[model samples]
Target: MSHLHIPDGVLPVWLWVAGWVATLAAVTVAGRVAERVDVRRRVPLLAVVSALMLVAMSSEIVPIAYHINLTVVGGVLLGPALSIIASFIVEVVLALLGHGGITVLGLNTLIIAGEMVLGWALFRGLVNLAGRSRVRLIAFVATVVTLAVTTTALVGIVAIGGSGATARESGALDPATLRFDNPFSRGVFSLGLFSGGEDHGHAEREQHTVEAVEDEQGPDETGLSVGRFAAVIYTLGPIGWAIEALLTAWLLGYVAQVRPGLIWGGHWQRSGGRMPGDEGTVN
Candidate 1:
């Protein structure tokens, strides 16, 4: 939700540049940790996880830049160190799909990295506090927290970008009353979300209508107010966030039941179930 739904050239150059610098630093640190640990077995899994994340994000849900961000799943399955690297890689690929601006890749990566990192930290702590019976509960709470934090960050970014009153007033989509013809809807459908047959005809109507409105509205405004930003995010965020949270929780619980070592390190080597030593190290 914090990925800056704004298209290219909207954000100030300095902000995006700083984003890239921060991402590069995170990547460098993650690389160093991966190398030092020599979790040789974990190397191959990186490709699999990255691909999964790419597919999940690429499949966008309509109206908002909302998708089932399997961040919790990624953070839990892949350690925080690897999750950071993987998130950066996923953001780079997203650029090719016209997901986010190339210049803002660093900022986007930072937001996603925060999600995974918080998810990982909270997942471990919740498991320790609540015990294994409530695995799903822990993941659910962790995801909610992650989404909350990310949404706040996104609001801050919009405010920092200094969006004007006009843009702020019209920028976000109204959930209670959705106007079919808007950039948000068209932008979402462009990614193959709604296609083919009579249902698509409705989509076309909205898309074309929005384009016409854009023509009538004249040049697009650059900035959006924090109110508008939060409006769109909260309106669209809860559904997807809840969906991802429930799924992440259930899936993690399932994984824990069958192969707990896949999470919290390979502690399964000693026995049948419930991770060996399940103690002394988060990873």
Candidate 2:
């Protein structure tokens, strides 16, 4: 829900550069933490979770301009360290596939990875507080809270990027009407093989591309202030968050029932105090 799909050149140079530096440092730390675990076993799980995140993020909910991010699910299964690595992998792939600009890959990775790490901690804490029998409920609550925090972070990043970072797309949502103005918009779901490729709303993007080429100075302020942008995001964010939370809760609950060790025991468990009934660290 918090994936920033802002195009290249939108973010200021220093901000994105800092994002890259921070992301590299995070990956390094995650790698060091992963060294204690059996990489051979964890690698496969990492691949699967990363693939799931990539798929979920590739498609957009046309109405809300939102996509489901399964970072919470990844966090629970892979734990924080592996989840960070997986997030970096997914964001890089997403950038290549045109889900977002390559320049913002590092920032996207950090935001999504933060969601994963925070969700992991929150899920563990809630389970400890409320008891493991309510795993699904714990997952739901954790996912909702994680998405809320990360979504706010997303808004903050855009704000920090200043007015130039505002997206200048045509599908402007009328805050008063609570409706989109783009006539080509279809139903809620829109899937594209490559997000930047020809699909639903391709014409609008093509027009924007031409306009961008004409405007040598880059994007002119679309009059979409940070406050209004934040309003639109907050307006639509909860719907996407709740949808994702339900999906994650069901998924984690299923995994917990079949493979309890995946949730309760892993590298994250080794780094912290173990939970009751945990069968030592595995993978």
Candidate 3:
């Protein structure tokens, strides 16, 4: 859920640079895992799955900032190793569309990757516990747990990042930019999307582009208190989680019935648009 929209200048160069380093390290780890698993076959599958996640994240409902992440969905289908790369790809693509800071791409990757991994972890266990009898319940619980962990991680990122921000930068820092009270908002996910206050009521924005919210030079230093920021995050987090959990669960249940192999371990196939396994194919 942590797709923080703060433009390039808001974050210190050191911090964003560090983010890139960490992100690259993660990608390296993902690469190692993929090589062991079978890079020749999985790369094509990874691209297709990553593109799907990109579409879901990009399709923002302007009225409410709700966009499907399908982070867990990727984890379930692609496994944690490939999902990290997939999440990073989604973040980079979103930056190209001007939805987020180019400098902070690595950080956003870390946040989203956390979601993908946790969702995979929970679902891997829960799917076993539920067996084949209660697929929906297991999915619902896994998604909710994933959201909770990711959202809480969002707060930690904001708190830490905000603390490292330039305190004396001469710019207006508006906390109201969050717009959490608005009925039609991005909801908890917006915690990941918030930047130096962009007018979000433009519900009809073309899906292909995102207006750059950060200043070309840098973002204004945030003056939002950690206590207040955390308070708002906690307040809005549960609402968004519950809503997304239901949606995610429904999608998982549907997928389970149609392509059981996608959810559980199945023979990996290389065909794009479909994942064929011993159980069945998902197309």
Candidate 4:
């Protein structure tokens, strides 16, 4: 729900520059913190989770104009430090693939990393309060809350970006319903999977769709105000969040049952090195 999908030269220079600086600092800190763990053992898992996130973020669900970000899932599996690193890698790749512009790379990374960190913290804290037995419920609640917070952050970033920080191409939003109209009508549920920006056909179709919407809506006075933009996001966001939360819950529950250490913290063996303050339980 938080993927920017903005093109280059859109956001102001100051905003993107600040985003780059902050992202670099976060990644540096994440690298240093990651050194405390036996990162070698988790390298493969990191790669897997990063790839999954890439796929999820690249594909837009047609109806809701939303994408599933398995960032919370990554956070649960890889923890905060590694998840931050993964977020950077995923955003960089997404930019290269034309999911969002290179200019917004840092900002996008920060948003996704926020989700990972928040989700990890919430899940851990909730587990402590509710107990580890309810892994599914904990993951669901954590995912929902994390997405809500980060989506609000995304809206704030857009508001700060001035008029250029629209969620998608101009006139794409149906102001009355605050939902993006689906240009693709092949199916009720469609996955515009990784069309990349290079798809000439898809690009043409998108242009036509925007023009058509503009003609139908007549003159647009809304002009992408924070209030209207936020309405569109909030209207669609909860649905995506619930779907993602369920997916997170089912996946985390299975992982917790089979390999509890990954979710609970540390390794199954004492030699694997435990995180500070973590209750390392050997399965």
Off by over 4 Å in 2: 164-224, 268-283
The whole-model C-alpha lDDT of candidate 4 against the native structure comes to 0.77
| Per-residue lDDT of candidate 2, residues 1-283 (tens digit) | 6778777877788999999999999999998888666666667778888999888887788998888888998888777788889989998888887778798888999999999999999998998899999999999999999999999999999888856644544454422123223447543433343333333434466456456544744455453378987898899999999999999999889888887776767644574433323465452
| Candidate 2 clashes between residue pairs 3 or more apart in a chain or in different chains | none
Global fold similarity of model 4 (TM-score)? 0.73
lDDT of 4 by residue, 1-283 (tens): 7667666776778999999999999999998887767766557667888999888777777899888888888887777888889999999888887677898999999999999989989998898799988989999999999999999998888788855544435554332223222657532332333333232234455566556766776544334577887899999999999999998999899988776666665532335465422445453
Per-residue lDDT of 1-283 in model 3, one digit per residue for the tens?
Answer: 5467667876677778999999999999888877875466678888998898887777775444556778877887887788889988888888988988899898889988888888878877875676766777877788888887777776777677766465545454333343344466544333213455454433343121122334432434334466776787677666667766787788888887876667654333343433434445332
lDDT of 2: 0.79
The per-model lDDT (C-alpha) reads 0.72, 0.79, 0.71, 0.77
For candidate 4, give the lDDT of residue 112.
93
For candidate 1, the 10 contiguous residues with the lowest summed lDDT are 190-199
Q: Candidate 4: where is the Cα deviation over 4 Å?
A: 164-223, 267-271, 274-283
Candidate 3 vs candidate 4, lDDT winner: 4
RMSD of 1: 11.7
Question: What's the TM-score of each model vs. the native?
Answer: 0.72, 0.74, 0.73, 0.73
Any idea how many clashes model 2 has?
0
Candidate with better TM-score, 2 vs 4: 2
Is 2 or 3 the stronger prediction by lDDT? 2
The ten-residue window of minimal lDDT in model 4 covers 172-181
